[model samples]
Target: MSSGHTAVTTALQPCGLPEHRNCGIREVLDRIGDKWSVLVIAELSPGTRRFREIQRGIHGISQRMLTLTLRRLERDGLVLRTAFPTVPVTVTYQLTDRGRSLTHLVQQLADWSLANMAAVAESRRRWDAANPESMIV
Candidate 1:
């Protein structure tokens, strides 16, 4: 390792976990890394939303997929799912304090993606042009 690049140790910090103790981090990422979770989270960030409202906010998400995503978020304690007693059951989803805390993080990620997308696209284009054999159909 270079003198300037210190070797990273297992210190319980995220993005740096001990090999055997990575399950916790992995599980957390599994919850957040999935495409739908962040979108659903963003949709709920503004306020509580009905199932259809969240579905409409996120384009191309199937009803089954949205239900599953909401279930997972609720299970993780990031989202609160409330079922109202109406003639037809009305369900709403909202961010818990934990989920609310993630708003800034998600927004920052969105900002980063926006800022670097062009550079990333160019890099990918260059890589594909240079390494044609490695490209997959």
Candidate 2:
């Protein structure tokens, strides 16, 4: 195993470390650390929302991407998906208890980002100025 993976395994275990081919921490992080998942969870933090409402709330997310994100969140037991038999088959999503727990953390991170945005921007500007060749755009 790579040193990074071994570090994670050791940190996660710390007592009677088991042989882990796959780690639950990595799996959960892979889902929640994605760009859309955190946003989607935060959007649903308010209350239940229809498909269009979620899409509209999160700008720049394509319909297909939103659908996939919602599906993944639902599968992970973070979001509850409810479908109604209507003329257009209406669907709404709300955070489950598990989702609510995760939302609290996401909100805290958002708050921190907003609070330190200027500092972060300044840091980025300095880094970019110092490393012009490393700039992507």
Best by TM-score: 2
State the displacement of the C-alpha of residue 33, model 1, in Å, after optimal TM-score superposition.
Answer: 2.0
lDDT per model, in order? 0.90, 0.90
In the range 1-137, model 2's lDDT, one tens digit per residue, is 77665344344452224765454676888899998999999999999999999999999999999999999999999999998999989889999999999977998999998999999899989989999889454
The CA-based lDDT of model 2 is what? 0.90
User: Candidate 1 residues 16-131, lDDT tens each?
Assistant: 55555645777888998888999998899999999999999999999999999999999999999999999899888899999999999999988999999999999989988988
